[model samples]
Target: MEQARRVEADVDSCDPCLSVSHLSLRFGAGCPSCMAPDAALERNVCPVCGTVHAVRDVSFDVYPGEIVGIVGESGSGKSSLMKCIYFDQDASEGDVRALPFDGGAGNILDLSSQHKRRVRNTVFGMVYQNPYLGLRMDFSSLSNIAEQMIASGERRVDAMCERGYELLGEVNIPARRAKDAPALFSGGMQQRVQIAKALSNNPPILLLDEVTTGLDLSVQASVLDLILRIRRDYGVGMVVVSHDLGVIRMLADRTLVMLDGRVVERGLTDQILEDPQHPYTQQLVYSLI
Candidate 1:
């Protein structure tokens, strides 16, 4: 069984807003890679050939107003874990449950395709690393946000536009540019718009995958600040995946460190940085300094 440890910290004592238990995903029938603890594979798979354990027995929880950061290098399966929760990718095993979901503790993975789509729109919001993936570049920013509202079952043009205009302003985008296409916005502005769209439905949980992967330093700071404010003011739970430790430190209340598709360490952000228990974490911390 995978462990979800709540080490020393000031985490909320309330029930978890989202719970992921013993989640494991493997691609391909036969994989032979360095991830095998021994030649005897309990999961009976490796990281080589066609098979890859994108996420291995990973488990964690996020409270109503907490941020959980997953830090790892590219291909370390951090993003995969996020996707599984958001239902972007199906897990090979294990289950995920979220509060406010009608199914209660039922595994969302087993939900029908239509119900899954409903969950994506109403229960969770996802901000992909690429704005292009999250936004409709050809559509105006207002419409981009309105589209989400429509999917979430909102009707009435005036109400949708009102929410759209409000979201644009909330993301720091000038209200005057609400009608402008996303292509006309800078990368930073586009990312801001993406955030606005992600929050349009006011979902309880937000999944941010490498949200600051490509951007100028100043723009990155602005986005990070916006996220901080949202959590501070709105009490939204978030799962943030990033390769940059600094980004994780700034946004996450708790951090999970992964290597080769497995979480080797997890704890309060300060503890992980100051007293890394794993050798890989030690090297990563020193490299940051």
Candidate 2:
């Protein structure tokens, strides 16, 4: 794998908006045999202890105005890592810090539930792979965005409505459909609504998990375009997780390749696409060709 020389130069000056260090998420207790540094497990599962190490020792930083991509096969811990970051699922152990929260001095993973919620509302905006998980299906699209704004402590209805309409249009959701429930919208529209809701609070960082997985190619393109537009317009740092390298190539400034609960390769997107280090990463890149 040819490592890009430019990555170090590009990140030398700016402080990271989000930093994750030695993050790990596991299910069930681990035995010494499977817990060793040299332990070999079946994929991510401990054969002896029946424990699933969904993510292990993953670390990364997202700088303001940068888009970082995490790519891997299904069950490779990519989505699991995102879930852990957003507190959808608590990580067994890790440290996550955002500059917008506590001057980046506190480990958000260890914060109280109340403080964590505050981080979710004010500092990080999350879009899940499944629209059902990210949006209120029974609520109006406008109401969905307002819900997020309200969580962020916005009390002015007129202000929330203005923001909601602005975001909906930004994501290409028509104002005419603003009052319609997401249950009545198509998958792509629902996803647009979710994106609109995620941006309702003007968060400093966005966590997007497989936002285009099941959409049609054209719809995926539109969603991808919307993401780029959002980044350009809002200048928010983003962590985007996907199984597709093509998507990463289209959007990520930096890319991380994961396999069996660990990051196997990381570099500038072009560097990884041009020269993948790990065998799994090679397979993924070559498949795209």
Candidate 3:
């Protein structure tokens, strides 16, 4: 696979738009046995307390205009980490800070529900693996965009309409088709509409979860191209999650490999592809070959 085009941002000079540290998610109360720093579990589940450690101390940062990728097989907790960052799932333990909020000093996870809602509306835009989770299937594509803008406090109807059309057009949705419901569109079109909605609020950080998972190869290419173009034009930082290393190779500057709820390896995307350190990572790279 061709290496992803490098983002032009001076990453070290710019502060991260999003920072996550020691993020953990568990489905049940944990026992001392499974909660220790040296704890080992049967897969990700605690045999003692039956707690599902969906995510374990995962951490990363996304600089402006940078795309950080998380790649892993099913049950690796990459998706769970994304949900925790976006507030869809409550993290059992972690600190997440959006630089635009409180100068990144406060942990957003501890914020009140009202403030969390504000963060979700203004600081982060999330596109889920399932369009149904990100878009209102019965709402017109334009209306979907409007809904997000409205949540972010856009009150001017005219402005929302203009922004909606502009975003839809940017994602290559025809102006005429913008009025149709997403349920009526193809899978790729629905994803494009979901992306438009995610961008409506112009959040600094975008969380994309398996955005091109089930599309045709040609459509996947189009979606990936559109994502790169958006990053180039808007300079938005992004966290892209996918099981497909090819997609990660095509879009990510840096990559994190997760297995059984923990990050097992991380580095420049090209470096990891060329010389993976972890056995799981080696397996992943070899399978791609």
Candidate 4:
């Protein structure tokens, strides 16, 4: 009898425009020889060294309008992977191929810095783990959101401000507070402001790096609900990097489980949660419970 071949998930649903293949990244290589001995050795020496790998050879495709969760413990390389996909960091090896709006083929990694900035400004947006990092402490919430639209070349200050106020209202922040800096708001309110900023340009893909960290349980739940609503309303593809299984269950259609810098499992959210096959995944599920 012939051995059975493992079946892969259908690629039909994956966006033809976004493709990532055999991605890998490592640190310590950038250290100069004069600054550090064994710099060459450090190049290949695992920073995590038999522990975590930061981001091992990983590959995945994200379809337009799909919500994918990248879940792992701290140091599992969830954030690093998102950084690479978002073009914030260069991958040591592999390819991130994307199609331009004009139907030109482009490699995100190979784009010139200027082009990369253009893509980031107009084509992609990100939400940081800390809401304060996304805002200007010296500026009002309305101005913070409008600034992003301006940077992305929206050009008309009046229009940006009008749209900014509309987004603030959309995220449920009161118009009265629009003139206040995010510092004056509670954690949840600040997060709402961050969401408004991230959505200002209507980017097709939104990379959210632990958007609900450090909040109380109720606040976290509310933020997650708001995120889900934004996903439906905007129809944007989202990659949510989080350690919280509850949040993943609420938002992700598919989940990728990372352990010590490697992807240990990938499957539907409920299936993997219920019947995880990898030992590391089992431990993660147990820890969640």
Give the TM-scores of the predictions, in the order they appear: 0.91, 0.96, 0.97, 0.85
> Whole-model lDDT, candidate 2?
0.91
Q: Please give the distance, in angstroms, between residue 225's alpha carbon in candidate 4 and its true position after superposition.
A: 0.8
| Model 3: CA > 4 A from native | 1-9
lDDT of 4 by residue, 1-289 (tens): 0100111233354544456777777664443431232222322344333222357677876666667889988878888988887777787777776553323366688788887877777677788898766788779998998888888888887898899889999999989999999988998898889889988988877789998889999999889988889877887777899998778878887789987566889987778888999988788788778
Superposing every Cα of model 2 onto the true structure, what RMSD results? 2.0
- lDDT digits (tens) for residues 1-289 of candidate 2: 2333444565677899999999999999999977887888999999999999999999999988889999999999999999899998999889999998888898999989999999999999999899999998999999999999999899999999999999988999888999999999989998899989998988999999999999999999999999999998999999999999999999998999999999999988988888888999899988987
- Note the clash tally of each candidate: 2, 0, 0, 1
User: Per-residue lDDT for 117-213 in model 3, tens only?
Assistant: 9999988888888999999999899889989988878899899999999999999999999889999999999999988998998888999999999
Candidate 2 or 1, higher TM-score: 2
The stretch of ten residues in a row with the least summed lDDT in candidate 3 is: 1-10
Ranking by lDDT: 3, 2, 1, 4
Itemize residue pairs with steric clashes in candidate 1. Answer: 32-48, 33-47
lDDT of 1 by residue, 1-289 (tens): 0112342233556777788988987787654453454433433345245466788889998888789999999888898888888887888888888877874578888999998999999989899998988999999999998999999899889998999898889889998899999999999999899999999999988899998888999999999999999897788899999999999988887899998778999988777888899998988888889
How does residue 268 of candidate 1 score in lDDT? 80
Residue pairs in candidate 4 whose N, alpha carbon or C atoms collide under 3 angstroms: 15-63
- The lDDT of model 3 is 0.92
